[model samples]
Target: MQTFVTEAVDWPDTAPALRERVRALVAEHGERDQVRRANSWTKPDPQFSRKLGKAGLLGMTWPKEYGGHERSQLERYVAIEELLAAGAPVGAHWIADRQSGPLLLRLGNEELKRRWVPAIARGEAFACIGLSEPGSGSDLASVRTAARRDGDGWVLDGQKVWTTGAHVSHFMIALVRTEAGSERQKGLSQLVVPMDTPGVTVKPIVDLTGAHEFNEVFFDQVRLPGSALLGTEGEGWKQATAELSLERSGPERYLSSMVLFLELVRHASVHRNPELDMLVGRLAAEAWTLRLMSASVAAKLARGEDPALEATMVKDLGNSYEQAIPQLVQAAVDFGSPDNEVLRAVCFYLLQVSPSFSLRGGTREIVKGIIARGLGLR
Candidate 1:
């Protein structure tokens, strides 16, 4: 019998000062009520992103040569935790700072890194993931997007669906099949495809929330220079698999409804409802525990370790807890004293959008399968 355990983490003493700095920065974004910044990582706002970049809060872990501050990943977490908790608008730089920039620093060649990493760190260029497809939702190995080798470049001709922010992004770190006859997960290669390349089209995909956070991007004989290839040929599967550690385990996994959580607490306090206050306390405990679990995962990633099973665990359980926040808020308000117009509006919006918490990153079923495999149950 395998026993799963999460070791307790001792946060660095510097964390308090770092959090205060980020808190002061977040305070500058004032009037969160007007913006509704919940889940703002998926809601792009270039101006806000640029401000974060100028503040030197985006790329906290990378080398200073590429416009980074070379700060520890824990400090980065401090800044991001404060940003997400305050519902700051960070969507524009979220993907670039979180995944793409790091992926480039790890895999890209000198020229490729020099060209994109600085701009990414500066929040000058935006990016979107081109992994999911119309027919291949979570089964990424079955992606149908193909990139055929041309004389000195590649001609990509396929469609990538459910690409978040593709319509507004300047680039896509796409995974395409380079070897036509190769089987699943083989012959796959990662490429940096410029969105402005001719024959590339982006069709917006609106979700149930009446928001356009997804897009179906089509490549009709789109051409990319040979340098666009990231890492090595036929190695994209490995690169992509390794890259998901950040996507699945970060603070974003649990903070999707943080704004709503804060608002719910404020409403409960105003009414002095014991039941609602109890729910808030329970939820706060859950968030604190999950943060420690997630911080453990971050520590591993900082050391260049994947910790796949641990990251998957954080995402699966954290998303469930995040999804429940808005539901609990709605129930609390419905059963007790109602909230004012502002709190009610936040509750309704989070209630509408929280369903996606489990969908993105990876579904609960998919993640649990990984956990089962890691525990030798598969």
Candidate 2:
């Protein structure tokens, strides 16, 4: 693959101070029990989100004129790493804070930015991405959702599967075909549709872990005003391509499985086996590498460059590490009894959830295809 690492911007001098501030905030509200009690992998507590907003932690990259702190992306990244590492309930504001807000800032009309950016930064508004449809894993061009231009708006009709936070989000950044598909990436457009729009419905999808995180959202001739469209018509494919890089590379990629890693490492240290120690060392090294790769992407993004291929590499490798945690840990940690409820429960939870790490955001096959295309090997 064409290595897409832009010249690394010097780590912002402000990064350490911001990291310390975020770390302090985490220390104040951080609790393992609270994290365990959080129900959905995709939904976050509204109260927690408000608290984050009050702490001036949201909208780290937007301009100050828009109620943002105007911090560099690297600083924003450090804040996210601290939040995810501490297992904070950031799900409610995650999509809005990370992808939707930044996207709107880029392509939204002035009215849209003025109306939504402050609310998003304040955590009073939340958003979700409505990109995937049934059997359309990363094949965004194949989406069947159709939105026909009406007199002053558009009528949308389609279903989106595995839509995280769809049930509770105030808005969804939806992709739909605005024209016939012959143009390939053309003829596609993105719209910011309110979840409360008439004819919209969200149904929960329970996973093996009994988590109600993903959902199937249906739009039945939903009427949206012209203002709801995000960017110029037929520009969604380009917009979404850039946005996926934001999704694919980040602290969330590796930190989701960190609690499990800590548990496994603790078990190994107590048992003190050479094999387990070696494996832990290797995993830690990989984790550090992912951090460096992610940091490089953050630096590039800060410089107004999109390092899409580099971000995909981080996601691909980072997610593999996430999935491997349960298997490798399972092999290393042998409970005295296979039927031991404590050990069995942890094992079952990790195994059931590991599959989701690779599936969400983008699948392994889809990521590899992107990498291949970058290399001109396809």
Candidate 3:
């Protein structure tokens, strides 16, 4: 792994300026009604995602040459925090805007950077990550999808399960094996597979909550030009590890549970009990700590460093925190007071949805394994 040092880059002098700018955009264009009614895990509106692109909020942290606004990652962090806190329906462009664009910017060829970044920043094109496979959940290197060099391009064949937004996405940046049956983490390659291609098939997977948020994608003899490869052909493991650090250590980690948290607060503020007060205080403190840790990782990303270990730490802790929110809320509601219908409804929705919070991005067990390995304990 290459080491990139993170010296303190000057935190933007007027950080509030960027925050207010994004907030103003959110006020004008944020999908407030839909977001409040439906969590972003459900399908998102494409037009709203395009509006974010036009506002220059999608790829705010990349270089200007590639259609990014060249804003600091911390500024982008502020934008994301506000979006998620408000429960904005950023799901349509979330995977692309957050991780794929940045991954392409960092590891993609110049042509890919020139081609995809502008479209992504403009929100005209959308993408999703294809890291999870049928049998391999968080062990990305265990993917069985194979890409064989054919003529001047690659022919791909395999199935990817639990792929988020594959049904709606225009492209899927997939991790497939380029070499046959290599050891634990070798010979895997990342390829950009267009969703509309001939051999690509996407079948939606309905979750227990009755939400069609994920898909089982099949690629059979799917051929792509050599340009489909993101980086080198046999470097998928390193590339994915580096890219996932960016994916796992963001505001989304803490924000998924925010809707339920806010509803709980709304209920608690009026039906005041000492236990509810203490619970809110404790949750507030945890939220603050998660924010600082996420910010630290963002600062590292801004400096082009892959804080892989730190990112694992953040995700592991954040998942634990997120998973606990619903249980904690239920405990609070059960002990003291009469359950408000709205609060009970929100809690029920969140409880049903909480399992995926740990599964998505990376599973808790996977994150802990990474942390252990990083600490030389593996």
Candidate 4:
């Protein structure tokens, strides 16, 4: 049976410097509202994203020829964690910088690279992953969206639902069936569909907070060049799973409720109680543990290793930790008091959104099943 491998991660020596730079940038331009900062990573501010691009913080690990800074993976990790901790508005470029750009650099054709990579690195372009569908949530293999060859090009016809950042994205890297009559995981392919394509449509799905972060995207006979295909056709399952390892393990997974945690700390400082004290301690410890686990996965990625199981594990635990913070704080603190207004506001916001923490990367059931299979329990 396999087990999670934990080891001391040797983060880069440049980490401290990178953290300082990110903190300074965020202080000057980050979101200021406590409620807005609760899940800051999902807060879109195109101007702030542009500022990060100008600061050489985006695309830190890719080739300089592709407009990247050519920095180490851990350095990139440091920058992102600092951004999340400070409640920086990074959602505009989050998907692009986090996974899409890296996937494109790894798998895209020359034309695809030339057309999107540099723009993405500059934060002028944003991307969204087209994975979930109407009947398919985390079951990627159940995707029915299809692409067919048409005289040296491809025609895409399908719809993707619950796509985060779709409305703000310039393009989408979608998983679709390439070969006719393919089933499950076979014959799947990733296609780069420009959001501005003639037949593409994006409709916003507003959440309970009246936020338009999720979207439904429709591709009605969208046409693309052969070069739009990402990675090997019929091997999209493998490529996409690899991309998901990048998605599942990151600071963003655990830091979504960090602003609330900070508010909890502030409330504890003024209103000292044993219950609040214990809650804060427990949350802090879990946050630290999740940070270590996440950093370990990042280190493995830097070394060209696929720690899919470990990444899945980190995401599961991190999601649970983040999702619990608001609930715990609401129970421990007195929201009826006027002094706890900031804390009350942040907690309520997170309570509404924390349900999505486990759903986004992969649902709790799906993530746990992956873990069980990895351990030979399934």
**Each prediction's Cα lDDT score?**
0.84, 0.80, 0.80, 0.91
True lDDT of residue 260, candidate 1: 80
The TM-score ranking, best first, is 4, 1, 2, 3
Question: How well does each candidate superpose onto the true structure, as a TM-score?
Answer: 0.95, 0.92, 0.91, 0.98
**Backbone clashes under 3 angstroms, per model:** 0, 1, 0, 0
Higher-ranked by lDDT: 1 or 2? 1
lDDT of 3 by residue, 1-378 (tens): 422233444456657776787677767876655224335534476887888888888899888888889877777888888777777778888888888998898788887788788998988778878888877876566788899999899999999988888888989999888887775678898999889999999998898977787899999899998999998878998888777777888878877777778888988888889999999999989998888887888888777776888877888788788778889998878533465776777677777887877877777887777777887785
Model 2 residue 36 CA deviation (Å) reads 3.1
Q: Alpha-carbon error at 247 in model 1, in Å?
A: 1.1
| Best-fitting candidate, scored by TM-score | 4
Q: Tell me how candidate 3 scores on lDDT.
A: 0.80
How do the residues 1-378 of candidate 1 rate in per-residue lDDT, one tens digit apiece? Answer: 533346655566788888887778768753356336778677777877777788888888889999899988878887887888777777877888999999999899898899888898787888898899877888889988999989999999999998888987889999989999887899999999989999899998899978998999999999889999999999999999888878898888998888788777777777787898799899999999889988888777777776888889899988998889878877778533344666677778877888888888777888888888888895
Report the C-alpha lDDT of model 4 over 150-190, residue by residue, as the tens digit.
99999999999999999889999999999999999999999
lDDT of 1: 0.84
Least accurate 10 contiguous residues by lDDT in model 4: 1-10
